[model samples]
Target chain A: MSAAASSRSGARFWTWLSVLVLAVLCLVWIYPFLWLVSASFKDPLEIFSKGLSLVPNALRWDNYVRAWATAGFSTYMLNTVLVTVGTVLLVIFHTSLTGYVLGRYNFIGRKLVIGVLVATFIIPAGFAIIPIVDLTKTLGLLNNRWGIILALAGSGHAASILLYAGFFSQLPKELEEAAVVDGAGFFTIFGRIMLPLAGPVTATVAVLTFLAAWNSFLIPLVLTFGAPGQRTLAVGMLAFVGTNETDWPGMAAAATLSLVPVIVFFFFVQRFFVEGVAGAIKA
Target chain B: MSLSHSAIRPSIRRRLWADRWIYLFLLPTVVLVASYTIWPMFASIWFSLLDWNGFERAGRFIAFGNYAEIFADRLFWNAFANTVIFVVVAVPIRVGLALLLAVVLNAGLPFSRSFRTAIFLPVVTTAAILGVVMRFVLDPASGPVNEVLLQLHLITQPINFLGRAGLSLYTAIGVWVWKWLGITLIYWMAALQTIPADLYDAARIDGAGRWQRFRYITVPLLTPFTIIITLITVVEATNVFDLMLTLTNGGPFFSSEVIDIFVYRQAFAANIPRLGYASAAALLFGVCVMAVIAAQIVVVARLRRRVAEQ
Candidate 1:
């Protein structure tokens, strides 16, 4: 073959290869999700009974109905929603405030404060889990939604602050200078000018925080173990598994229900979310 | 006092007073962080000194007893070994696979967006529940994989992927790699994008082969990302408690019990819970994680200085 023909064939081979690789990647990534849905519809007793074609014996809504009722998914979901919302709000408010001030002002101990926040990531706050539990108990926060919310909100300080601060630093000083000239005080400028303009970072932190709070398990497990009624969906599913052992259909349905909300939210904001998280890492 | 010195004192005081709003803005975060994050961190070290079962309000101070116990406990060492093995085996593979995937997807593959989303689905979705769901996939009996294996005559009997003592930790790590691979891929893509394309073009023009270009340019340009990615991996890997809890529960005769599982078991799972000992294990684990991160920070800081100097 001529050199040009060989190069063309090589290019063609790569195109087909990429297509094949991407197709397989998509399949493998999606298979578990598909299996989850299929098993959710299977009969609890009849799951995998037909030799594992990943097909349900029938499309039974019973598992979902049963899981929703038996496992008290409604309460878990409510608890999760409360914790997640509170965490996102608190984190955004606190970190955005901190980031804005740190970004705009040259202040004493600013470097120390930033260093501490960043160091928290390295130190891994988990060493303090026991003390945190005791502190929560002392503060009467254990088994309370507020306990989990406050704890989670206090975490993720470094990344969120950095992301917000990056946004804050990039804003033209003229905008803030105009606001300062308008007799707007700190909170005023922050609320009206800074926070409004920090939409992208806020959205990024909110989505990330929301997903984290929603999916957290061990925190709720440790804090709310004594108060089973207050369990989040993640911890509730653990208990559900303990009780409904081998109830594959019901378990799968429970898992699916827990994941669906986040999955949907992720799909909508994914393009932005990926860019946001990657962007934060760069900062 | 000299005129300039005296004048500067008042200005400093005025600056401090005028910046009260900065303080106020930072007050909630400072107070919340101090109470919830900082306090607990210091408190853990104190807790590690006591001989307590965790339920009681107070306990005797047996200085260094918990740490001594941690050092001596066979299970602790087993867990330490297991965790080290996990980091050694899992982190590189996860980061490596992610780089490969990100490189391919960065080439503008067909359906790149959906592919990124699909792979990243596991990261954002309820991971613990996904672990529980994965149990179904890896179920020895009535699992699709087993059925396929049987159909293909790969094995005579259903293999217990999660139940087997040897395979449990590695299996869990496999799941870990799969779950978090997308985030790493995203990071790699972001880092790769920062490198101008013309460098590659220039290299090609200079008669540099693809391997030479990638070796000299891509690898050098990727150092900061590699450092950051490794840092993220270390942090993420050490925090795999919930997944472990749901996946194997550190089971099959404790073959898979990493330090996180070890800590949980001592604090919560054991019939004779030793909270102090658990704290010691956690402290050690935290120190190790911090040491790794501190090293990475030095590298990252050096990289930053080099970039700045350049």
Candidate 2:
């Protein structure tokens, strides 16, 4: 009876201790973002004088408007949308077909091709800069939106394809067979049937690819350096900080603006995002 | 029989034509990949051998000279060391924090879902944007971090976070840990979801404490996810270019110069564009990263098999 009572007490103590520790950690983890939002609304005097404030004396909504327009963010946002959408569409279309071929078909060098694609995942994107730049210049793609799109399109990650392949393999091949028996052409079957069936994985790919392209800085930075007007939001935001003399309020405002689209996308499609990533990890 | 065999051959050819739709469907993707990615990979190999700038007309091939020079450069070595340090330190902390958060969130605490969501918010934010935010937060005098520390009497003087030489890497690592902990947490949470609840129940009934259950049951089962995520984290850390560029710019000294930034500086910022040398450094960086990832994947796979056997 005494032992049972002691054990109960110990469990209570542990539960409380765990809660305290987790609360501290949660705060540490979240403090930066809270600070970011706080800084955005803070008066310049308060920001500079008080360092950081959790709340501001007055809300400065103009900071966001000025940051958006003056930083050439309108153009940057447009470019990012175009590039991200273009890349996601290309990735979904190309990777599905290629992943389908590699997943479902028996062909020459199929394994080797898949292996090579997987290997490129670890090869840092930096290594290809010279050749990419040279090729872009040669093709007159330098400073062009197509340049950014093509550069991102070049590397299809094998893991993502393997993931699609894994899911595809589990899918009953009977559907494709039925389409074939119905005199549906191979492309038609792929386009209508297989593509539609790949919706979940497609969502995953779209979110991951979109975030990747949207966050891409170095590729576009080096590729589009000369064309000042052709900057993506990330690159533009960086240039904004530099040009605007590190305006803390303005910078924070821009940061928030740049994050709005992604955050919105994340909230709406977060279920798919989590499942997609989790599925990939499991495989 | 010979006539029948010839007839079958033509039918096979006709069937292939009928199936030509699939080939046509694959054509655009194949063309795009071949032109953009496959061709550029080959082009990189070719360019790595030449002494050509973006505009140079004719280039002379220098066999392994670039590689030799890359091995000799001091900055190349520093960048390599920084990349290694960043990977070694950041990957473990990120993974560790993530696993801990996953456990906490999965403990069935009230409002845990909201907690998980809040923690994971930073993962969705832009790295470049976070860089700017971190710059403001870590500022010596005017940053909230130092202000809080000063108020709490944690330090006698304001510590120069990103402005100091040795401390910049730590600052970058802190920013990295905060931004990355969210996604890694999600991965862990997902992995945790797959763990059978009965395993924990059995451990509890066997008089195992929370820590013991965590160590024996949770950790062991979670090993596969941990190994995979560790490798992913390491790969991502090694490519730490944009954040470093934005947060510290490899400054207050050259303390934070990873190989990616090193290549950029040499190729673009150098008084004379040593495009050849820069390409060589980049290639060396790539080779080193690939080797590390390959070795890690092998080790993880072997460990996973051993665990399964047990």
Model 2 over residues B1-310: C-alpha lDDT tens digits?
A: 1111243444646645644544554566567656666676666666667675555655679978888877788877888888888888898899998888788778877567777777788888788778877888888878888999998999989999999988899889988888878889888988999999999898889999879999899887887777788888887887777788899887776899888789888777676666777777777677777887788878878877997799
For model 2 chain A, where is the 10-residue window of minimal lDDT? A101-110
Give the poorly placed runs of model 1, Cα more than 4 Å off: B1-15, B205-209, B296-310
Which digits, one per residue and each the tens of the lDDT, describe model 2 over residues A1-283? 6998998998778777877777777787778777777777876777888744488888888787777787777888899999889888877877787777666764444566666676666566677777677777888988988899888876655555776776677778678778777998667877888878888778777788988888888778878888978988888888888887658888888787788899898899787777777776777
Question: Residue A195 deviation, candidate 2, in Å?
Answer: 2.1
Candidate 1: how large is its RMSD?
A: 3.2
As a whole number from 0 to 100, the lDDT of residue B58 in candidate 2 is: 50
lDDT of 1 by residue, A106-212 (tens): 77768988988877766685686777788789989889999998888876567889878878988887886687678876778889888999998898888888888
Encode model 1's per-residue lDDT on B86-187: one tens digit a residue.
Answer: 888889999999988887787776778778877888888887897888887888887776777888899999989999999999999998988888888889
Best by DockQ: 1
Q: List the residue pairs that clash in candidate 2.
A: none
- For model 1 the local lDDT of residue B208 reads 99
Q: Model 1: clashing residue pairs? A: none
Least accurate 10 contiguous residues by lDDT in model 1 chain B: B1-10
Report, for every candidate in turn, its global Cα lDDT versus the true structure. 0.84, 0.78
Interface RMSD of each: 3.2, 3.7
Candidate 2 ranges with C-alpha deviation above 4 Å: A1-13, A180-182, B1-19, B300-310
Best candidate (score: lDDT)? 1
